[model samples]
Target: MLRDIDPMGDQASIIGGVIEFIKEVQQVLQSLESKKQRKSLSPSPSPSTPKSLHLPAKPNPMGEVGACFNSSLADVEARISGSNVLLKIVCQQIPGQILKIVAVLEKFSFDVLHLNISRMEETVLYSFVIKIGLECQLSLEELATEVQQSFFSEPVFLNEI
Candidate 1:
């Protein structure tokens, strides 16, 4: 249901703001914990003060979430296997994107042998196995270039598989 909401709209902005706030809070908490540790190390704590009074430091999940948000989702990898070409792609979910991909494959005259699509949160991964007919004469490098250009607008990581 959350995916139904546009990421560029008000709800997305609100979520972004919340994530920013959580990051700030996590930073402050980490700094306070470090300062507490330093103070405890320098001055001798009184015997009456229980050593276990301070809570254990918890891992910061916000930092990991922020990193995930900041990183690019688009990626493309291709490999040759006998008469078939294996292609793996990761791109942000968008309307009409799948149709566009199918169109691109058609444009290059690739016969789809097998296709698998998986959606994870805001991104989608597409794994395609295709056969290049004798009519299609594009080289692997050229195919990579065309797919990189046609697949998504974001920076894509293209690698050989």
Candidate 2:
């Protein structure tokens, strides 16, 4: 899970990971579609029929901020210079994701000195310049591993900077 897409690593591996993720998503969509089709085909239902589990759509609380979407999963790159760590993270533009990252940094005793966020159609790129705390004991590799595993259930690509 701590795999890094280093420049020196095989390019095929990265592509393979992306392809695998896409296939899984497609499968889930197809399953949902099939269920919808079956429900529509039945014009009337008896009392014994089980109620559909689908819930009514609700308005997005984030409004404009929640409209963005991304075609790919998350990617992160880490570079260390002296006591400072430079991080470049690209992921879906979801609310509270940045807070999760910040929480991890706090747990590791890293202080964010600067942050730059760029938003496109469906993705966000976060560039962070942070200072390593004097009491921090983890190495750069260990920090990368921790970040890689922080994302809830999505795969993360960690690249070397």
Candidate 3:
């Protein structure tokens, strides 16, 4: 199995590179946060005196905040009811990731009831209904967490029941 290879030679190097990349990303996030705090400490340069300079600025029609780009994974949703769990995932159009999700379910011993998939442009949406046996002995939270970690994205649950 890929997870079972000894982490000493080539695998070690790859793991090290990933760790270094994560550290770099964390540092960049921290730096951005510090810059944001610094900018919040001071007011912007005021315009020259005008007839009604003291009046407050008008609200923007668009929004109060600027636009931001998020490169994170698409959304994943899950819910459990009476020994059954349903998962809805929006992911990149990657076949391997979908397979990986199935593997995760198989690994955890869940019986899949239904698998539905749809695509729009570059994204794929998946809906899965799975049945969990009492013998599985895993809580809903644990199961949801496992799915999230396995997919490397947060899974939103709809009314945890």
Candidate 4:
């Protein structure tokens, strides 16, 4: 329903404004209706996007040179099987600390699976999930202690959780 009926005033301007307003309202209502229709069509929750399960791409040092190499050569020194270790550490708010942590893990012969880093206020939180063979030379406790000692310092707290 349109209101503000004008008799002597500029009818064209008032009518134009009303038309624009109606168009906007119609667009909004159409969007809402479409959303409702979609929801009704999919009463059950849609399956989660497969993209969520994808792990982040790790940096490959060998680059294109290794790409052309034999596939069997890549599997020669593989130690870890299907098991992995998840490590979470909180450290001082600084730069290059994560790189150091990764270097330590590599030094200990642990293959990093997934790593996530976040900052909570003044502290930096790091989560590293690693994979190691059942015959891994270093024990989990030993590795955790070594990592903690390597990264621990004043204003930095390292913990594996």
Q: Whose TM-score is greatest here?
A: 2
How many angstroms is residue 90 displaced in model 1 relative to the true structure, after the best TM-score fit? Answer: 0.7
Ranking by lDDT: 2, 1, 3, 4
Instruction: Put down candidate 3 lDDT per residue, 41-111, tens digits, no spaces.
Output: 75543323111111222223633211111123434445554456767665456546666677677777888
Model 1, clash count? 0
What is the TM-score of candidate 2? 0.49
User: Once model 1 is optimally superposed onto the true structure by TM-score, how far is the C-alpha of residue 98 displaced, in angstroms?
Assistant: 1.4
TM-score for all models, in order of appearance: 0.48, 0.49, 0.46, 0.41
lDDT, candidate 4, at 99: 63
Error of 1 at 67 (Å): 26
- Which of the two candidates, 1 or 2, achieves a greater lDDT against the reference? 2
Q: Is candidate 3 or candidate 4 better by TM-score?
A: 3
Tell me, by lDDT, which candidate is best.
Answer: 2
Worst lDDT window (10 residues) for model 4?
67-76
As for candidate 4, its clashing pairs are 80-133
Which is the better candidate, 2 or 3, if ranked by TM-score?
Answer: 2
Q: Model 4 misses residue 154 by how many Å?
A: 13
The segments of candidate 2 whose C-alpha lies over 4 angstroms from its true place after superposition are 1-72, 153-161
Writing each residue's lDDT as its tens digit, candidate 4 over 88-141 gives: 554445555666667678878778887755554454445566887455687544
* Lowest summed lDDT window (length 10), candidate 2: 63-72
